[model samples]
Target: MNEIKKVLITEEQLKARNAELGRQITEDFKGKDLLAICILRGSYIFFSDLTREIELPLEVAFMHAASYFDGTESSGKVNLPDQNMLSVEGKDVLLVEDIVDSGRTLAALKATLLKKGVNSLHIVTLLDKPDRRVVDIDVDYSGFVVPDEFVVGYGLDYDQRFRNLKYVGILKEEVYQ
Candidate 1:
């Protein structure tokens, strides 16, 4: 079992940052057709909080795509289980994610959506780790820039535990190693 090593982001901090992001998004796409897509499982918490902040008429969708499975690092291959569930054609798409690391999953998803002919595409991530990116990806809106460490809580997980923690934290080294 892994204990939380340190509190990375407090609950109050998350709220403030997400609120800012929501306001910015609302202003940026004031009258545009916006379809916010949540990269599922990991992004559920962030997605819910963010969508509530945006004061605009928009639609919400979830895509269960993942590149990590019961491990500390990514598996390097993104899997989209419900690929045909939602259609994003001709919509201004905003991809909401829990974190952006390695950039493999987000890059693949962005390419897939672009091929579907989205009118515009933007990315919003609750956390970003620029040191781990393997592919070039642009994050339009980001909450925090984290160090190169395995973090958990706030929808990010390891074997799917600790997600209920209100704040973001660093996982104990013993847990993953």
Candidate 2:
């Protein structure tokens, strides 16, 4: 049975931070052709809330990418089964992701998008676990810097469960073992 070990970020904190990020993005990308690409399965919740808070007019798209294969840690290899098919030529692209852990997934996705001749490519993630980063990557906006722990909730999951939780929390060690 899976159990929450600790609440890392509360729902209240998420709401406040998301609002701030929205305002910042709106200000930063104002008057630009903004195209927000949400890396799905984990980022949908954050993308939905964050995009709604952006005051500027923008377009949204979903790209299903995965590096984790039903486990707590990444498989090192990133896969984008659903390729980004939108026309990104000369458009400022913002990749919204739920977490930036190993950074492999984001790096691969960024490389792929860059080939599409985007005007600019930026990354925004709800959580960042810098200690686990195998590839160096910088995020334009980050909601929280978490420790090296297995987290689940607020769209993050373990074996595709616990995503519906309102707050972000660490999963019990026993759950993933």
Candidate 3:
């Protein structure tokens, strides 16, 4: 079993922040055609919590875009299967993500969504790790700016484990090493 080094963000903190983010989104997108897209696997928990908080009639969609394939480091190439089913044309899009690290996945998805004729695009992430970023990308709504560490929980995972934890925690280095 993998051990956690420390709890980085508590469950209470995440709940409070999610509520705040929802309010901000509701105000910004009042009466607008908003489409919240969840970057699958990692962002499922966060996407569900955040979308519920938004007090607006917005559409929700899911797309699978992966850069880290069961590893801590990104493979540098994003794998996006079929996104043709999503209707993004003339709609304000909010890409919901669990964390933003290397920025490659989000960057690629942003470009693809824009090409699909989205009226506007914005990103919302549960955690942001600027130190690990390899590409320039902007996160519109960020719950927390985390240090470059191997964190897992609340939809974040290591080899598809630890996503069930309610709060974010740093994984013990020995487990991964």
Candidate 4:
């Protein structure tokens, strides 16, 4: 059996932090029509809790993107998910993602949305890895800034697994060994 190395953000902690993020968002968008655009597969969990915590009227849209295909390297090309059909012509849009590892995905997506005619655009990533950032991307809101270790759970993944784990953890070496 593989022993879990350590747990970073437990489920309870995640809930608390998520609520805090939602409160900040609620306060910010109190008088505006906000669009919560979640990047699929990863940010879905974060997105769901985040949107629910907000007390204001909000619309949501989802998009799937893949900058990392295998191992720990980014493909540098993003396959945008199909749920980007929400009208952002003049709406305040917040691009929500699970993690920003290399900053490539968020950077590309942000530029793409800007070109799509969003009235205002901002980014909020649940986790950030600035040490591995390849581009100078800045997230407007970040839940945590983590080291460059491969993390799983709380929406992050490993070979598309472990996403359901309630806490975020650095996979034990034996798991990879």
User: What's the C-alpha lDDT at position 45 in model 2?
Assistant: 92
By lDDT, the best candidate is 3
TM-score of 4: 0.92
Alpha carbon lDDT at 95, candidate 4: 88
Off by over 4 Å in 1: none
lDDT of 3 by residue, 1-177 (tens): 349999999999999999999999999999899999999999999999999999999998999999988668899999999578798999999999999999999999999999999999999999999999999999999999999899999999988889999999999998788
For every model shown, the clashing-pair count is: 0, 0, 0, 0
Instruction: Record all residue pairs in model 1 with backbone atoms less than 3 Å apart, i.e. clashing.
Output: none
What residue pairs clash in candidate 3, if any at all? none
What is the TM-score of each predicted model, taking all chains together? 0.97, 0.97, 0.97, 0.92
The TM-score obtained by model 3 is 0.97
Sorting all predicted structures by lDDT, with the top scorer first, yields 3, 1, 2, 4
Minimal lDDT window, size 10, model 2: 80-89
lDDT of 2 by residue, 1-177 (tens): 249889999999999999999999999998999999998899989999999999988988889999998677789889987775678889999999999999999999988999989999999999999989899888999999999999889898888888999999998898779
